[model samples]
Target: MSLRIRNLQSFLRPINRRFPQAVWSSRVVTSIRYNSSTPNNNSSRRPNSGEEGSNKKDTKDSDLPATNDEHNELLEKYNPDKSSRVGTPKGAIPAIDHDLASLLKKPKYEYNPENNTNEVTYEFPPPKSPKQLKVEKIREKSKPKSRFKKIAPSLIAAGLASWGIFTYSYLTSKTDPDKDGETGLLRPDKFLPYVISFKHQIDDDHYLIELTRKNRHKKLINNETLFNGKTMWSIEIKQPDINIVRNYTPLPLYVAGTDPVTKEPHLRLVSESEEQGKFIIIVKKYKQGEFSRWITGLNLLHPVEVRGPIVEHKFPGHPLDKFYIKRPQLANLLSKIKPDPEYPEKLPKPENYVYYGAGTGILPLLQLIYSPNPPKGFIEAYLSIHSESNLLDQFKTLNYFAEKIGRVKFHYFIGEKGEHLSSKDILKPTLPNFTGLSDIKLSEEQYREKLLAEKREEVKRQIANGGISNEGKKSITHEEEENHTIPKLDVSKFKPDNAFQQFNIFKKRKTTPDPSFAFVCGPEGYMADVSGKSDLNNLEMVDNGPIGGKLKEKGWTLQNIKRLQ
Candidate 1:
């Protein structure tokens, strides 16, 4: 019902206690008129009580049974506090009639961080600023005396062992009290180091030694410098005692005999008996060879250290199976040939002869050719005579021998034109029968021909192989200037008269000298020639310099011993 209508009805019906019935009715009528005048929809479109319409329906059921007593008891027990409503949930705001279910529910209180509901959300007051941890130093405690006592024996033993080792070393290496600083064979007072000995003379601006390192001894046993101190000879048969020579430089110097057991360095002597023994060492004064100079300074009859006779040259077969060519062959050859009656008889004969010696290359060759101990057959004699002056005497000597034997042949290439025979002159016998280099003569054409002929065959072959020739091909691919040049005959193409053929026709020819048996002692070119020729026999010729040296392009070794040093 409307508020005004309800108020008016209540006023008209109940008025016994307060009097003024007219006044109350008049007030109610007035309020009713005012409410009727106002618009109803504006204030009461819906009832404030949610059960307003539903209450009318429940009134009919209430007449059947009154549950007020049980309901009152529930109210008394659940709602002891009058301010709270127990029948309906207390403090529940009425839900709005809308589509949103969450909005219809009670609004939750926004959380304050200080009063968080989650128990884990509590943060322990930020860790109190941590204190720095400090490292503590430890104090050492003294060990008991018993521990040191136990280890004392071990320490003493160690010290004794170390001392013993030191003492042994000192004793082994200690010098003799009588001859301080002396070890090997000689005493300190007369200690003689291994040195080269030479006799000198002045020629032009150079100082030349007539001989070099004639004597070298292993031990001081029976040492003697014979032939007015020009020759030295010593005997060392005790192999096991002197292992230094062979162990140090195992190979033979000239042949073998460097090794004590091998006895290869020992050579055969002219004497019919085999007891004779000697050693010959040929050393050249190189541009700068310290060993050569040292050898020249040694004194006669004085001790000179002798190393192995490493045999550089070999026989027909195995090279390692060598003997000393110097002591026997070289010595024997020298005794027979050397005009000096003073020459020793103990020396051995030179198996093969070699010249081209700066100073001594000619020594062995001379001895072999002229000596009674000459090789059983023909021998190769090469000489390295640099200057015309040195050649004069040598040439005369060589000529005499060549004519005397008529079996010996020579090959000589001169680097310089003057005072030396050209290759052609030597190859072809000319007027005066020019015995040596001084007799040869040549013209400009001949010189040019000689120069052009060198390596001509190789050049032609290279061209034929589509290397340099302008042949039929349209294109010309020349890698070098030499490729463009034409080939001509040179010394390489020159074939000497076949001495073997002559031997076969005239004298009974033995087997051709095995090229391997060639004895080469000269400049590098001479040695190379021998080596190359010896290739036919598979000879293992010894050469010091590596292939393709500075003169590699010229196809020659600058170290060639055209003339002796």
Candidate 2:
């Protein structure tokens, strides 16, 4: 163990001879240092700081196990790489201990980018706290929980609040708490309850049905805006079973006939009191008409939904206002109808009228004529019937008019007899034909002026009769301005004497009358001779096109003629 060979001599000897001499030394240096162009990759780019990086650096400087040094000599040296550092005083160099324990220290090579001139530089890591490693390990173990899981409860609460708002809005919309009052026999927004009180089966294809309000005793909206005879109005019957609605024209007539009567009474028009909460309809089911078939198959006392008083066609003016009151005025006079007492010419005489109808197209007109207060004109209705049996089957319908209606003359064109309505038949050779428009214009002006004169006459009569009181003078002014004369609803409201009421049912009018209007309505080709080629395919009630048919050639303008559907 005491055999000591010099260090320089051992390095110069052969490999086999040096091994024997190295075995006698206390420590072995397993590496030899040398310089090369390529940087030594054995060093890490930058060791992770702490005890681990320093340990790695210590072992790297020498390829030997950690050991004590043989010499106590220490040297102060200037690292050349740190000379490129900025802001150092001129010729000022910092000293570093180049001892064996300081071999772990390494300078970081860097280049100064801020300086315009390119230069090499070095940065030494600052000394860290000895307990920095303990702080980092604790941070790794104590990380915060995921933020999404924390917000889950808030998301669910917001979703529930939105759902509650939507549910409230939907329920309120259905209830419609703020709706105003409705004014009709039927409501547009919701269907009112009704019971089928009467159903008459005319044939396999035709039906006469009546619908009465559930609360039958109460009167409907007490107004005549639609039921007035001046315009043709209709309503729709809904079939909830099929989810469909069909438009129907309701007649004022109800079946007064009983099954057991020896002489079945003809269908009769309803009195004003009876018309309040009841209506009748004529339904003719076609081959594939689903809505019609459903209605025709209903039973008496079955419930149905109805809506409207849809205005179909409005005539020119209230020409009959002077002669008519509310409908059913003739119901009391059915037993005995007589002519009006003839007097010298009245101020405003009624006009003459002509009408052409094909099949069911005549229903609207029938409503106008049967209603008690018809226009102050007489109508010559020319109807087209499919066959002779059609008339026999419609006996009750014909009887209603023949027995009660006045001022209407019917002329039939039987299809089975091979007869069709033509323009020539509408205006015969001997009939008054005023070709020039002056006659029609003069008639219209005369009609308007005569209306005013008639109103003044009515006012004079009321005054002359000594029926007005000082308090009633204000009401007289309003009555004179209004065009129509409405009947009194309550018996106490009548100003007429007791004797007049007892004999009031005896009132009548002249059978022979005036005519002015010419109306045409039917199938497209059925009345082509009188009206134009119309497109009835569209169900909407639109304005008819320019009057371009045989009636136009016969000197009829819109002033005197109309083509109705």
Candidate 3:
């Protein structure tokens, strides 16, 4: 048998040598076929009958060798399985055993449904002992700090350097004469130029101009006591070819008004600054006035020179105090007439102040009236204007003050003939041309009679309107009657002659025992006509005028009258 096998091998060796690669490939194919065809009892059962049978046969054939011992040994020497098989199936991935996979997996705590509760329990770390805390603090201190903490000193030094530079620049620039030279009547060292920060139109010809100081001079303008007392500041403006200067009394920087939503009185918001301060000035443009034209034509950031808290007037204890020495004639007259018992030490502030103003001349008076703490008295202001629309536009601000004080009386005199009937008309006879020439002015008696007649007509009208009971002779209650009555003082169209009549009525009205004063501000002729020689019945007059010659002619001494222009 061995000799026969050797002869067969000798015959095959020549064929193997001639086709070495073919022989190796055939051996690999035979091995695969034998492994696929063999069956084994230990093979796993499959669901598909045909596939299960094939897999069983493949398992059984894998145990049997296809060639003799010599061939088997040679094949084993060149077997691809030794390097590549790795115990895996052909084209099939090796799977981990169930027990081995479980050992390799991360351990997990099984969830218990019974332990799932809505209440949450937190595991807090145990508190450290005092000694441990102290040790930790010491360790933290010894450790290196953050980058920001390390460079904090450098940052502070840089900040201080910047502040010093700014201070030096500010002091030098503000004081430098070449940089801020004197303009007009304003001295650069004292009054400086303020740039126009904002402009708001209050009316057709009225504007509220806000002026701000330059950055370098901000500290100078931030003076708390800059605008104090009843004084005015002068503004210097230069036109292309004209030099014009005007004096203005600035309005209060802040005012008190009722909040629209809350109906509570609050300090109305005002535009102001701290380091860079600003002030507002109200200007009224005039048709032919050069100063007004120049002011109105200014643009935003326009520089304006401003100076002073110019003293307009100073009040003495009495009207005759300043004149007592000047006029010797007053000494004898004053000795005979005992000083007023109510005002023995000093002339008391008027219990009732009747103010008369025309157009923009009313500004200073308005400022005084709306002062934070004005004189304790009632105010009756009569303003004469060219149009009623002008007063209507300012009604909100005026009404706010009126409502705040609750004692303010505002009477507007609109200058239009057809819209208003003159008080003098009441004295005229029914006939167009009377036989006897009568005085156009009405006597005091006639004026009182006319008022009585008007009151009777008003009562008759009320009776017709069911405000009074005809049969019972019973009228409406006082409160109900007041509701129907017109406002005592309100905007009204008036003839030029009506101003004198209104002044007379205001003077006649009864007031507290304290003395009263009448202030009149307007055109030369208007001031004269209102404050002219007339029996005021203990009412003193202060004329605000550009020219006091007319008042002086009327026996009004300089001491008795205060003028602002």
The backbone clash count of each candidate, in order, is 55, 11, 7
| lDDT agreement of model 3 with the native | 0.49
Per-residue lDDT tens digits for candidate 2, residues 1-565, read: 1123235324333332423332212222111211111156844455456766775665566433223332211011112344422331333122423662243354545755545355455366445576897788789768875788679889999999999987886677668854222345566456666778887665566667777767555435454323455777777778887888877777776666665753322566664654556667777778799888777777878878777766666655332343334322344343343333222232334456777887666777777765555654557788886865444333434435443445567778889889977657655212332334455566677778888999999889887755677787534455565855786566534443321232243333444443456787777876566766554455674445556666666666556666665
Worst 10 residues of 2 by lDDT: 70-79
Error of 1 at 455 (Å): 50
lDDT values of the candidates? 0.35, 0.57, 0.49
C-alpha positional error of residue 67 in candidate 2 after TM-score superposition, expressed in Å: 99
lDDT per residue (tens digit) for residues 298-414 in model 3: 899887766654545432232223223211110111122111112121222224445667776676666564333243345566677777545433334644444232335666667
Which predicted model would earn the best TM-score?
2
- Predicted structure with the largest lDDT when compared to the true one: 2
Q: Which ten residues in a row have the lowest lDDT in candidate 3?
A: 326-335
Model 2: how far is 291 from its true place, Å? 1.4
Model 3 bad stretches (over 4 Å): 1-155, 167-190, 201-204, 220-241, 253-279, 314-352, 392-396, 403-407, 417-515, 532-558
